[model samples]
Each structure stands twice: as C-alpha cells, then as structure tokens.
Target: MTLLDFVFRLSNRVFRPYPFCHSRPDRSLCYHRRYFGLCARCTGMYLAGCLMILSFPFRGELLSPTLNIILGTVLLLPGGIDGTTQMFGSRESNNFLRVVTGLFLGVGVVLFAEGVLFILIG
Candidate 1:
C-alpha cells in the first residue's frame, strides 16, 4: 500500500480514522478531515485538544484578557518561532522542542478547523 494506508492501519488501534474512506481521490474524496488519513501525531494533537476543550470548558473563559492572550501564545508561539527561526538561519532547532512545538501547532490547527466547522455547519 502507501504511507497513508500504513498510518491508517497503525492509528486504527487508538481510534477509528475519520471518514477519508475511498478507493481513490475523486469527487467523492474528502480533504478537510483527512477522513482518518492523518498520522499518529496529528491524531494525538487533535484528540488531546478536544479532550482539553471538553475538560476545561469554563476555565478557558475565566482567564483575564491578558492571560487569555498568553495562553494562546503559549499554545502557538513556539511552533511559529521555531519554524521561522530555523528557516531564517537565526538558530538551530532542538529536536525535543521541535516535536513539542509541532504537537502544539497540530493541536491549534485541529481546534481552529473544528471551531470553524462548528460555527458554519453546526
């Protein structure tokens, strides 16, 4: 098979892949959700963000405006800074930090996408 098929098979143990079911890319194929086609880290980030949102529901709103900003920065800044700095050759990236930041970025991506879909369709 392919990388996508390999990952889907591996991640099937944790949770069912989204609805990316199809024999090939065509009019019937979906992209937004990856239809369960994304790899492990992507799925973990999304699942973790969803769990955090559900668990911390009201707490997310209780923070002051500045704290909210800080929280947002904490969740997103590292990924952007690390990726950008590396691109500009300002500093070499640490592997651990890169992975951590990537996870945060992934989480942010899923949360943002889900929020948009919920607002528009739900």
Candidate 2:
C-alpha cells in the first residue's frame, strides 16, 4: 500500500470508533473499540443515528418541526432515561429493563438526529 493509505488506515484505527454505551462485564465493546463499540442497544442507537442521517434526503415541504421533535424524543427518551438512571445508581435494573431502555434510547437517538437534519435542511 502507498504511504498515504497506510497512514489513513493507522489513523482510522486510532480514532474512528465512538464507543458509548457499555456493560460492566463487556469491556472489549467499550468506546474506541471502533464504531459504537457497545452492546445491542448501543449498536441499535448507532444504527438509528445512521438511519437519521440517511433519512435526511426525504424531508418534504409539509413536514413540521414540532412533529420531528416529538418523533425524536420518543425515539430517544426511554433508553436515555433508563441509562441515566442506571448510571446514577437509582437501582440495579434487570436485563429486560436494560434491553427495553436500550431499544428506546436507540430510537430516540435516531429521532433526534433526524430532527436536527430536518431543521437544518429546512
């Protein structure tokens, strides 16, 4: 490979992933593992974010900012709340709760991203 290609690959390895959500027992999946190095929900959130980005091209003239904001909140809130609560030590949440929270948070993230893109594009 060329020197530029080698450098690009090295840089990507050094600073590409944006790891975020993580479980105590799964350290390998932590941030920096590359590309939302997290559990299932985190993975979902990342995907949602990508989806939001991908959806940017679909904005019609009739779509309202309020609707977009609502959708974004719905997508992210449950998971964000659950994660924040757990992080703050409110209580030890069970696995089912974790999964549900993660799922919601992921959706919320996607929604938020879409909203931002819509506002900016509009």
Candidate 3:
C-alpha cells in the first residue's frame, strides 16, 4: 500500500490498546473526528508531558526531591478528585475539564518520576 496508508494502519494499531476510546469510540470526546480514535484526556496529558520535558532545559534547575514530592501531590490531587468523582457517577466530566485535569496529572507524574529517579540514580 501507499506510505500514508501504512502510517494510518500503524497508528491505528498503536492506539488500539486504549480501552477507553477503542472500546467505546462513541463515548470519546475529540476536538475533531480524526482524533476520535484516542481519549481526549489522554491526548492532553501526553501532549502536556512532551511540552514539560521540552521546556525542562530552558526552565531552570529541577526541584529538590522533597519539594517535588509535595508539589507533585498537590498537582495530582485535583485530577484525582475529579476523575474519581466522575468515575463514581457523582457528576459527568466535560472535555475542557478533562484536559485541564489531565495536564496537571501529567506534570505531577513527571515530577514524581523525576524525584524517584533522582533518589535512585543520584
């Protein structure tokens, strides 16, 4: 097949494992139909994660492990609370809220991971 076709097939396979989107494609919230193949929150989270890493060099030094842990926990709480409440059916979540929560979750995860890495490797 053509290169475009091959890439399309590859991406389909790569995103197939997303149970939330793949299993119930109709339930997914996407800005465009083309992005319907993936969960919007996951997309936001990963995109923000990429941005966070990219900005690391220019931003400045990494935070200390203690600070990282505290900051990470603070950042993660909102997402956790929102997600859990939605999962339990207390309320429904919209794409905007999901994206915002996912952004915080992504950065928090990175901070926690970096703190662990520092403790382990340095």
Candidate 4:
C-alpha cells in the first residue's frame, strides 16, 4: 500500500472507540468532517497535561512542597467527584464541565507528581 494509505489505515485503527476513548459522538469534539478519537474530557486532560509537562523547564520553585500537595489535592477534587458521581449513576455531566474538570485533573496530577517526586528525591 502507499504511504498515505498506510497512514490513513493506521489512524483508523488508532482512533477506534473504547479502551482509550469512548468516541461517543455526543461527547466528542469534531474538526473538519471528523470526530476526535477521545471524548471531550480526555482531550482536555491530554491537552493540559502535555502543556503542563512542556512548561516544566520554565517553572520556578515558588510554591512550597506542602503547598503543592495541598493545591494539587484541591484541584483534583472536582474531576474526582464528577467522575465518581457519573460512574455511580448519581448525576450526569455535560461536556463543558467534563473538559473543565479534566483540565483541573491534568494540572493536579502534575503538581501531585512533583510533590511525590520531591518527597522521594529529598
């Protein structure tokens, strides 16, 4: 097969629903004529997480380790609660809320990881 055809086939396989992403049309973002492989929340999480990681080299040690941990935990709460409630059928969530909470979760995870790393290394 041609390279372009191969790439298309590979993308098709990679973007299939389930496991990584639900790929539900109602919950996914569309670009051009295609829907994203991941749902809105996952897209937000991945986007923010990648951005945060990219900014690591430029970050300063302004916040104390304890403060980092506290802040991280606080940031994580929204996503955690939202996901848990949805999972247990307590409430249904919308895409906007999902993306926002996912963004928080992404940053929170990085901060929490930094805290853990500090504890481990120091």
Candidate 5:
C-alpha cells in the first residue's frame, strides 16, 4: 500500500530463500535485501565486485602478473584470516571488520582474475 510497506515486503520476499537471512521479524540483522539479506561481509564482497567492474577502465592498466599476485594475496589475507578465525570459533567478526575485509577480498579477486586473463591472452 505505502512505499515503506512495499519495500519491506519486497525485501522479505527477496531474502526469504537465504539460509542466513533472519526474516522480517528480525530486521536488525537484515541490512536490506535486494542482496538476499546477506551478512555484512558477503554484502561488502558483492558490492565491491560491482564497484571493481564499474571502475575497471580506470584501474585495469595497473594489473600485471606479479603485481596481481602480490596485490591479490595482500587484499585477500585479512578477510581470509578473519573468516578462518571466525569459522574456527577462535573469534567473532563484527560487521565493520567483515565489510572492510570483504571489500579487500572482492577487489583482489577482480584484479587477480584480470591479471590471469591478461596472462592467458598473451
């Protein structure tokens, strides 16, 4: 009926299938769901990927094989560490840390992929 109500329903419908989504009743954790109500880390990773692709023209020339490997590894390291530690229950990951790490991982993946493509093509 109302715009706010429409958005709420839409989010619920979109996120309903996700295992991690808490549902309408638990909005605090639901960040917003055109993104499947994904966790902050997941959200950031995806968003970052989109940003990377959109900005590829501006950054593409920077990707050489060696730099790609190093950059990718550096970018992914923090997220990997955080995620692994969380998975092992060694520590809990907060949303802020998750987003930051996820952004790095996402950007790294894009750069790594582009570099690999260059290598293969050449």
Candidate 6:
C-alpha cells in the first residue's frame, strides 16, 4: 500500500472511540472544515504529552525529583476535578476548558512519571 494509505489506516485505527477518544464532532477541534479525529481535550493531551516527552531530557536540570512530583500533582487537580464532575453528571464541560485542563493533565502525567523514574533509578 502507499504511504498515504498506510497513514490513513493507522490514524483511523488509533482515533477510534472508547480507547483514544470519543471523536465526537461537537467536542472536537475543527480546521479547514474538518473535525479532528480526537476530541478537544484529547487533542490537547496528545499535543502537550508529545511536547513533554520531547522535553524530558531537560527536566532533570530544571527541577528536582520531589519538585517534579509535587508540581505534577498540583497540575493534575484541575483536569481531575473537571473530568470527575462531568463523569458524575455534575455539569457539562466546555471545549475550551477541556483543552486547557487536558494540557495541564498531559504535562502533569509526564512530570509525575519522570519524578517516579528518577526516584526509582537514582
């Protein structure tokens, strides 16, 4: 198969609901008249997650392991609260909030993971 075909198949498989994203058009980001495969929150998560992973090498120099863990945990609270409240039918969330919270959640997860790794390894 051609590269474009392969990429299309891969993206289709990856973006399916229940695992990666809901892929609901209403909750998704639109560009050029096309909805993104993932919802806004997931899109934010993936974007920030990728960025965090890319910057992992520099994290050690900037923050201590304990600090990383603490900061990560703090960052995670907003997303956690937002998701939990929404899940329990407390209230609906907006796409802007979803994206913002998702970004924090992404970085928080990475920082938390890195902190744990540092503790385990060092």
Off by over 4 Å in 5: 1-12, 15-36
* Residue pairs in candidate 3 whose N, alpha carbon or C atoms collide under 3 angstroms: none
TM-score: which is higher, 1 or 2? 2
For each candidate in turn, the TM-score is 0.42, 0.54, 0.74, 0.79, 0.74, 0.81
Candidates' C-alpha lDDT: 0.52, 0.56, 0.70, 0.79, 0.71, 0.83
lDDT of 5 at 1: 71
User: Local error of candidate 2 at 103, Å?
Assistant: 2.4
Ranking by lDDT: 6, 4, 5, 3, 2, 1
Q: Report the alpha-carbon TM-score of model 1 versus the true structure.
A: 0.42
List where candidate 3 sits over 4 angstroms from the true fold: 1-13, 17-27
The full ranking of all candidates by TM-score, starting with the best, is: 6, 4, 5, 3, 2, 1
**Candidate of highest TM-score:** 6
The TM-score obtained by model 5 is 0.74
Q: Largest lDDT belongs to which candidate?
A: 6
Better of 5 and 6 by lDDT: 6
Off by over 4 Å in 4: 1-18
Candidate 4 has its poorest 10 consecutive residues by lDDT at 3-12
Q: Per-residue lDDT of 1-122 in model 2, one digit per residue for the tens?
A: 76655544554454345335443334223323332224545545556566655666784434466676687687667777776787899965655565566656665665665567768887
Q: Per-residue lDDT of 27-110 in model 6, one digit per residue for the tens?
A: 777654556678888878888989999987765447888998999999999999998999899999999999999999899998
Model 5's alpha-carbon lDDT is 0.71
> lDDT tens digits, residues 1-122, model 5?
76655654665566567664433332223323333355567657877988999998877576577688679778989999998998899988777798788789889888778777778888
Model 6 off-target regions past 4 Å?
1-14
Give candidate 4's error at residue 71 in angstroms.
1.0
Cα deviation of 62 in candidate 1 (Å)? 14
Pairs clashing in candidate 1?
18-36, 20-35
